[model samples]
Target chain A: MTIRIAAVGDIHLSEHARGTYRAHLDGIDERADVLLVAGDLTRHGTVEEGQVVVDEFRDLGIPVVFVLGNHDYHSDAEQEIAAMLRTAGMYALDDSAEVLLDGRLGVAGGKGFGGGFAGKCASEFGEPETKAFVRHTREIADRWRIALKGLDTDHRIVLSHYSPVKETLAGEPPEIYPFLGSYLLAEAADAAGADLIVHGHAHAGTEKGVTPGGIRVRNVALPVLGRAYAIYCLGGEEL
Target chain B: MDIWDPPHYVAARVQRAIAEDERTNELGIRVDIRGDHLFLQGQVCEEDQRERVAQVAAEAAPGMVVHNEVICVAVGEPGEQEVL
Candidate 1:
């Protein structure tokens, strides 16, 4: 069975974001089996802003799966925003996956992270606040690793908000390299094994790469240099 | 009006000093210029944030110099480039 997933990210909408995606996603049902958002749905982490995105997703006749982006945490009201998105018939995944409506494909997901590359990364046992940041990304990595490991499907796909390898950080300046993608995410994908890994958050970064283990990676940040969405095939189980 | 002076009163005198401190020193970051002079003082996250603050400050003051005192707070540690 073949499945087509419509995906995009970094909508960055606020209460004023109502008109943003509806016009774009109105014909979604005819597009694919599921809609995947790689994160940054709300601009300031406001529930009202998330609600705006949620309201727009109501136009979809298929399942919508997504991971929360850093912008979604700007406000402490993340739970409220998650609740609102859930109420709008979207599945909010963080290192988790669900059997796609077709059942042959399992979509695993996580928000992933940004810590540059392996040479420069934050250790979890640092200052209290610093520790929190490092630990958070580690947690994101570990959870995704586990979630992907747990899935049993004909086709496995991973969705993330942060780029997984340096290969995707092409156009971005070297000074800002670490901010665009994280090696931990690539590490996790390699260990768990996946067919296709989709992500965003590298607005200036390139759009493709591979884990050391050779799993395919795709970056879909809307403002990134190329196409808004990537179309791939799940007809064969390569792994 | 309120005695809550936004730590930027001394911004003009402390750009390098603030930029060297582990918590507030930065290289390519932009600073915001709000609640004060065309030059604003604040702690931003990344160089992008700094650049953004500078852009906003400049637009806010078309002719005046938007003195940038916005220090980039290294979320992790120094000797490092980013904390994101």
Candidate 2:
């Protein structure tokens, strides 16, 4: 069977652009079977923003799989937003996994960590504050790795808001690499053997690449760079 | 011996494709493709649009397995970003 996956990330929608997905979503018909968002659905994480996101997905042709970003919890209303998202039929994943494309696709979601980028990333061997940052990122990576391993489907996709590898982050400045992404996340995806991984957050980074394990990775931050959504297919004889 | 066989695995060709990628002055889609796998690398204009690039590249490969790893590089700093 041919399954099309359409994904985008970092679409910072607000009350003004409520239901923004209503218009451009038509591409889904000619494009994909499910939608994967790479986080940052709101200008400021709030129930209102979550509602807007939910409303936008109300018309999506297929199931919507999503993960939250730092912004999604800006107001510390992550739980409220997550609840409303579930009510709206949107899977707001947080260190979680779900089936999509009518169970043809196995997807895991996590907000991810930003201890910077590869070669310039953070380590867990510093002071309390520094160790906490590095360890925190490690925790997220560990959870994501566990979730990816738990997926039982033909094609597994990991959704995150931060990057996992430097190959995918060619354009971001080296200095801010630590806060932009980390090699740890990619390590998790690699170890878990996921088929593909998608993320946002590095708006200045490039748009395509791979993990050391050769799993696919894409950065889908909308505001910083975008034209429309992307479409990819899997589990076919052609591939 | 086959324990490490990859999904849509085409190790031989992907290595050659990436090696040739260094010669391109323009962002050519064919070179960006690995083996039969596709990876969208380099700078892009906006966030979500990077998705389209991957789609187009995959479509161009016609049955080649695709693995999108496209990151979104901001065009400018946060507030400095104006209507482009």
Candidate 3:
């Protein structure tokens, strides 16, 4: 049986955008079996905005899994927003993993950080500020590695708000590549094994890419997709 | 001589304002300064958000002609499913 996964990111919903987006989700149940929201569900990350996200996503009949983006941390209320999502019966992952589709599929990841790609990436040396920035990405990658290893399923997927490889961020300015994503994320997923990786946060990025390990990567940022969501079928003949 | 703010600096400031301003927390809006005009370009999800982004850009770079060229993103139905 193929698991149809519908994914999107960077919705940036707020009070002003209350029901405008949900209107587009009509008939989503007919399109996919599950929905994966990469991140950036709210414009300001406020609890109020989080409520908007809940109202927009709740009762969709499909399992809705999400992570918090940098925009969702603006008000230092990321935890509160995540709690709200959990209360609404949604899965909010923070460097964790979840088994869905009756344990046939496993998803691991969180809001991946950025430090550029392999050769051009940042190092944990030099000033404390620079080291901290790179270290944060390193830590998140480590947690993902652990999460992926713990999962025992037929297929595995990684969901994040940041890109894992630069291939998906082609249209974005090269100068900002370091801030868009890091290679550490792809490395962890590659080492632990995954069927696919989904991410966002690069509005101008493209939609498809692959990790060095041959895992497929898709950037479902709403702007990049020009649609409400994208559906990817796993456990097919191609896989 | 009134030394005008550097065009790059003006664009950077406006871009930062669009991302950081409470009224408009849009992170991907592109702000560009050419001569005396500042152009704002990006896809917002709502018409009101487009206006709010433009308003923040104009307030960030007063005295410059601000062009609000940002468009609203179309959230159409779910397209074809890619089998992997």
Candidate 4:
């Protein structure tokens, strides 16, 4: 049985976006078994924007899971946004995991942070601010790892708002790579061995990559996907 | 009298200007200074954001030439394969 997973990120819906996504996201029930939102669901992370997101997905009769992105924290009301999303029946996974399709598919995610990539990345031994920056990414990645490990489903999928591997950030300016995502998330996913990984936040980035452990990574930012969503069939003979 | 390079001053001012503006702050636009020229680059979700960035840069450094290279692409406008 192939569980179709549809994913996209960086919607950045605002007041102006009211009713914009409905036409684009209608009838997803026939196309996907589940929907995964990778983050930036709001332009400024307002509860009103979150309401718009809820309204967009309320009628899409399928399970929806999401992780918040940096933009979702801009207004510092991410908790309110998360709560609203939850009330609308979407799972907001922050350093958490969920089992779907009768426990056959496990999903885990967090709002991954950035501290550069492997070779040229930030370290915890520098300035206090620098340490805090890198430390946050490390902590999120660790939580993701633990969440993935705790899942006992037949197939595992990792979701994140920030890119894990630099491969997906290829088209973005090289100078901003550190801010785009971190290698720590990739390291955690690779360590846990996921069947697939999805993320957003890199608007100009490519759509595909593979972890060091060969787990497939995809950047599903709405801009990158150029679509309402992309569906991936998981846990079949193909895997 | 403290002497600072004009370009550096312009860059610093532009940086603060962008940071102070809510829309531009969310855009995370980067300001680069080369001599008296200011280059702005980042991904903004709206066309107005691009214009606002240039406006902010201009206001920050009145005499500096502003080169606005920010890309304004609406999110989810491309490759929309919704099964409608």
Candidate 5:
């Protein structure tokens, strides 16, 4: 059975965006079985913007899963936005796991964080502030590792707002790579295992990449894809 | 135009304002200053947002000529399906 997974991120919707973005999703049900919104559903991360997200994403007639991006946390309303989306019958993942397609597919994810990649990444050895920054990514990675391990579904995908590997962030300036994503995320998924890792937050990044462990990673940020969404088919006789 | 703030600093300030200003909280826009001209490049979801970014950049650096090169992101249809 092939699971058609439609994904996009960095929608950046707001009150001004009402009735503008949803038109792209017309008849999405026919194209894919599920839609996974990687993150950045709002512009300023305001509660009002959260309502816009709910209105646009709700009643899509398919399982729509979401994770918050940094832009969605700008106003410190990430929890409220997630809660509101949940109340609207959407699945919101925060360093957690959700099984869809009747336990056939499991997605584990959160916003993810940035600390750099591999040897170029940050470390815990430093001042309290520096340590905290790197530690934040480490802790999120730990939770994801645990989440991926607990998922018993046939297919597991990790959704995040930050890039897990440098390959997907090719267009972004090399200087800002640390702020874009960290290798720790890829390490976690590699340790626990997953079919794919989907992320955003890299507006200029490319659409496809693979982790050092050979797991596929794709950046579905709207600007990167230049499309409303990208569909990836998993677990079929073709495979 | 202050002697203490160089063109680089002006670019940085405009970039920061574009990201931090409530009127235009766009993170992906890049600001560059060449001579007396300030160039703004990147993509926004809407045309109005692009104008607002230029407005914010102009306000940040009063004397420079603001060139808004940012384009509206055209989100087309879901193209093809990639089988994994």
Candidate 6:
């Protein structure tokens, strides 16, 4: 059976965004089997902002899974944000995997960091600060790989907040590539043989791309999609 | 006569301009200088805000070319409404 996934990211929900999404997201459960929020669920990582996002999805009646974004860490309340979402019946994953649809689909998620792409990326061989910066991404990428490896479902979906490949980040400025995402996340997903990869964080990026292993990568940032959400039917059509 | 580094001077001027502007201050715009070029990067809520930010940067750095990399997001109106 094909699993319909409705995904979007970078909602950046704030206090003012309390009721903005419900109207746009109405009937999502009837449209898709599951909802995947790629990240940036809050504007500044406040519990109140997180509450706004949770309120929108509280009665969506579908399994909602999400990862945290860089913006969600702005106020250092990421833990509270995740807790708020979880309390509202959403699965907030960070370097973890969850099986859904009665073991039909497995989602591996991580708030992937940025360190540029291959051939022009940063390395851990530089100064202490540079090493730490690159190392953080490396750790998250490694966790992502491990999480995907642990999934035992029929379809594997890798979800993240940062773009895994440069293909989806096309419209974003090339100078900010290092800060937009890292290629390591792509390598991990490709090696793990994912059916689909969903991410956000690149607002100016394109919507679609492919991994080296031919897995489909999508940037579902709200601005890029030009809609409240997008539905992608995985395992039904060959990409 | 006071000597000024073109890029640094432009960066400082643009920073002050953005900070002093009510409409752009909360946008968190970042200014970078490369030689005589000034790069503005950030997200603004509206199209006019993007233009305003670029215009402010250009005016702050008169002789430098401004590269406006600011992205404008069309966020819908925010208010309380009945949940469906």
Q: Distance (Å) between predicted and true CA of B81, model 1?
A: 37
List TM-score (chain A only) for every prediction: 0.90, 0.93, 0.98, 0.97, 0.98, 0.97
* 1 or 5, greater by TM-score: 5
Question: How well does each candidate reproduce the native contacts, as fnat?
Answer: 0.00, 0.00, 0.93, 0.19, 0.87, 0.04
Interface RMSD of 4: 6.5
Candidate 1, residues A72-173, lDDT tens digits: the string is: 877777778777777877888867788877667788877777766887776777589877766777888888888888888877888888788888767666
**The candidate that achieves the highest DockQ relative to the unseen native structure:** 5
- CA displacement after TM-score superposition, residue A76 of candidate 3 (Å): 0.9
Candidate 5 regions exceeding 4 Å error are: A237-239, B1-4
> How accurate locally is residue A218 in candidate 3, as Cα lDDT from 0 to 100?
99
- How would you order the candidates by DockQ, starting with the best? 5, 3, 4, 6, 1, 2
lDDT at residue A134 of model 6 (Cα atoms): 95
Docking level for model 2 = incorrect
* Candidate 6 lDDT over residue span A1-239, tens digit each: 77888888987776766786688777777777899999888766777888888888887888999899987887788988888888887899989999999999999977999999999999999699999999999998889889999999989999999989999999887988999899899999988778889999988789889888898898988888777687887666522
lDDT of 3 by residue, A57-171 (tens): 9999889999999989999999999999999999999999999988988889999999999899899999999999999999999999999999999889999999999999999
lDDT of 1 by residue, B1-84 (tens): 656445354333334433343232332233343554555554443445566556554543455466766664332111111100
lDDT of residue B3 for candidate 4: 75
RMSD of each predicted structure? 9.9, 16.8, 1.5, 3.6, 1.3, 6.1
Q: For residues A1-239, could you state the per-residue lDDT of candidate 4 as single tens digits?
A: 77888898987887777886788777788877899999989887888888988888775888999899988898889999888888887899989999998998899997999989889888999689989999999999999999999999989999999988999999887988999899999899999879989999988899889888888898998767767788888866432
DockQ of 6: 0.12
- Please report, as a residue range, the 10-residue window in candidate 2 chain A with the lowest summed lDDT: A222-231
Candidate 1 local lDDT, residue A90: 81
Off by over 4 Å in 1: A125-129, A225-228, A236-239, B1-55, B59-84
Tell me candidate 6's fraction of native contacts, as a decimal between 0 and 1: 0.04
Q: Evaluate every candidate with DockQ and list the scores.
A: 0.05, 0.02, 0.77, 0.24, 0.80, 0.12
- Please give, as one word, the docking class of candidate 5: high
Residues B1-84 of candidate 6 have per-residue lDDT tens digits of 988656666687788898576434432477999887789887754466678788888877788889999887754322221110
